[model samples]
Target: MVRGRFAPSPSGRMHLGNLFCALLSFLSVKSRGGDWILRIEDLDTARCRPDYARQVEEDLRWLGLAWDQGGSAGGPDAPYFQSRRTAFYEEALGRLREMGLVYPCFCTRAQLHTASAPHREDGLTVYPGTCRGFSPEDIAAREAAGRKGALRLRVPEKSITFTDGHLGEVTEYLPTDCGDFLLRRSDGLFAYQLAVVVDDAAMGVTEVVRGADLLTSTPRQLLLYELLGLPAPEFFHFPLLLSPDGRRLSKRDGDLGLAALREKDSPEEVIGKLAYLAGQNPTAAPRTPGELIEHFRWDTVPRQDIPLPPGLF
Candidate 1:
């Protein structure tokens, strides 16, 4: 059966953007008679909160999302937190290192920012290969000098392309667009791309269903899979949930979080509004998760951002 997961970071409360992803992931698996897994991506020790994690579970349950495995809800694949998988990251990092795909980058954030200041795409920073030429002796000298560096995966200066089920064929330039991405931070923490690629492989995840915000990172991930001699999972990137102002919703939208809405105790109305935001008619408000799933149409999901309804709460 098709296997998927809803992996959320416990950095903050689940807001409208998160709700859209949760419902989409649940239905994506259910629609195919597949299993949905709930994975807590709480590896960022600096920001993850236990209370926030608890609320994530509660919010999904409130929205009627059930995972067949993982996390507090339980399944065969226990230990869902990424923080618990340090050894896995180390092993993957070792593999990439052995393959000569990963190298230590000594450039500081200030240096990177200065080099990237000239280029702009998607309103995000594009990394420059400032440290791509660091030699082994240079690395050793820096290490001897007690200098710590972030490990970067060198990208080929070529166009990378992949077929996304929802968005069709997608392409991006790795050299000019993506540059070298961090695999392990100087702070001794594994980067998200490195950790996620490793965890998904270890967990036997066959399909990845997430928002389009991550679409641009697929090629870099594909390179990691190739370097590790592993097959990349199929991808489906749905449209992002946007605010009424046409901007993508973020954790800053605390007002739109389910917990805030639950204070009103209008589960029926909340689901109806979320369903509508997901591009469904919601002709009659559905009372349960199962009922909402009954009317879910994967095809009806719009490729463009779904604007939040005005005064939704």
Candidate 2:
């Protein structure tokens, strides 16, 4: 059976943009008779609160986006919360170490983001491979000076290409596009790339549908999947929902969040308006998830970032 999931990091209450993703994910899976799993990515223990995760479930329920399994009502995959899944991450890290693909990187944030370091338009500092060739002496010197190291996966120069379910063909070179990315941070927490891939494959996720913001991260994950001998899932990178001024919506926008919206509009009203934004509903009239499932089509969704009307809030 086809399977999909909504893995949200519960740092704050979900906003209008978050609803856009969940509604589409639910509709996409329902249209295909697939199971939907809701996994709370509360791995960042510092920011992810239990109350926020509970609020996430509450908000999803209010919006009528029910999952077949996961979260509190766990199925075959129990312990859906990422915080409780460190052992799995450890095992995967162990495998990478056995394959000799893992190395320690002692670069500090300031050092990595120095003026000489290359950056993408989004200001992501491309890993400079500064420690790729680190000798035992170099490691000893860093440790002696009390500089801890984060684990980095050694990447090949090979090109990775995959056809997205929605965006068509996308390709990226591993070397320059995504340098030896992190496996685990110096704080000993697993990086998102490794954790997400490991969890999805372990949980039997067949397809990954997310915003285009994550489009660049896919190639890095594909490399991990290949190295780990895990079958890569199908991917679909869709457009993001932006604010009226063209900024992408985030948890910071409380006015456009689920809690605030629920106070003003009925659940059906919110769902209907979101469906219209997703290009599923012809008009933003009140409609439930079931009402729009039959009419849902990925082709109808916008190919570019959608700017929400100023009056949406």
Candidate 3:
């Protein structure tokens, strides 16, 4: 079956903007008789909370979105949490290590802030390879001193490009425009790019439906896949939900999350409103998940940012 997933970090509650994304992903997969998986991205131990994870499911259920597999209720792909898949990331990291595609970096946040290239409008920061050549002695000394460091991918000096299903023909320069990025942080946690690439491949996800905020990072992820000899998943980056002030949607706006909306809004109305926000017009006031799926269309979904309304619903 064609597969898609709605992976949400358990760091915060699900909001209206993200709700639209969830509905879009769920409906898209179901309409085509595909499987929709839910992966809880609780890799950030410092930020992820068990309560928040449970809240994610509750909120999604409240919004009428369901998944065929994943999460605490495991399906075909058991052990869905990224935190539980440490060995998987270690194995992938080992591959890059053997291929000499990854290197140890001891740069501190302050050092990186000073060394980074000018930020792009899309928030691209080229990281100059500073500790890419740290000798064995240097690593040993740091270990002895109990000083922690991050592992960075050795970005190549070439143009990385891919055709996005929604955006089309996306491209970016890696070494010059983008920069070598972290695979593992000093806290011994896997980086977002590393964990996502590893998990998606392991889960056998076919299509990835996410917001456009991640469009620029595609090239880097592609490079990682090529290095690991893994097939890349098809991408559909739809419009991001934005704040009324035209900023990208964030958890800070507690007023936008589904739980916050449920206090005053009807679930059916909220779902239909989000469908319309995705550029699909429902024929009737069908108030269930099935009806929303019947009217969802990939082509009709808006490709630009959807402004956060003063009130959702």
Candidate No. with top TM-score? 2
What are the TM-scores, per candidate, against the unseen true structure?
0.93, 0.98, 0.93
Question: How many angstroms is residue 211 displaced in model 1 relative to the true structure, after the best TM-score fit?
Answer: 1.5
Per residue, candidate 1 scores C-alpha lDDT tens digits across 1-313 of 6788899999999887887788778777777777888889998888999888888988877766777888786655568888888888899888877878788888777877784354646655666666778888988999999999889988877888899988899888887777788998999888889888877777778789899989888888888887887768888899887788898888887778776778875666666776776766555364555666666676777888777667765
Show where candidate 1 strays beyond 4 Å. Answer: 115-120, 282-284
RMSD to native, candidate 2 = 1.0
Instruction: Please give, for residues 1-313, the per-residue lDDT of candidate 3 as tens digits.
Output: 6888999988878777678778878887788788889899999988999899898888878767878889878876678888888899999999999988787788777777783456777765667778877888988998799888888988887998889888889878787777888899988989889889988888888888888888888888889888988989999899987788898777887777666688887778777777767777543243667776776677888778888666544
Best candidate, lDDT-wise? 2
Clashes of 3: 1
Predicted structure 3, TM vs. truth = 0.93
Worst ten-residue run, lDDT, model 1? 115-124
Q: What is residue 129's positional error in candidate 1, in angstroms?
A: 1.7
| TM-score: the better of candidates 1 and 3 | 3
Model 1 TM-score is 0.93
Where does the lowest 10-residue lDDT sum fall in candidate 2?
117-126
Two-way TM-score contest, 2 vs 3, winner: 2
Question: Order the candidates by TM-score, highest first — what do you get?
Answer: 2, 3, 1
Give the C-alpha lDDT of model 3. 0.81
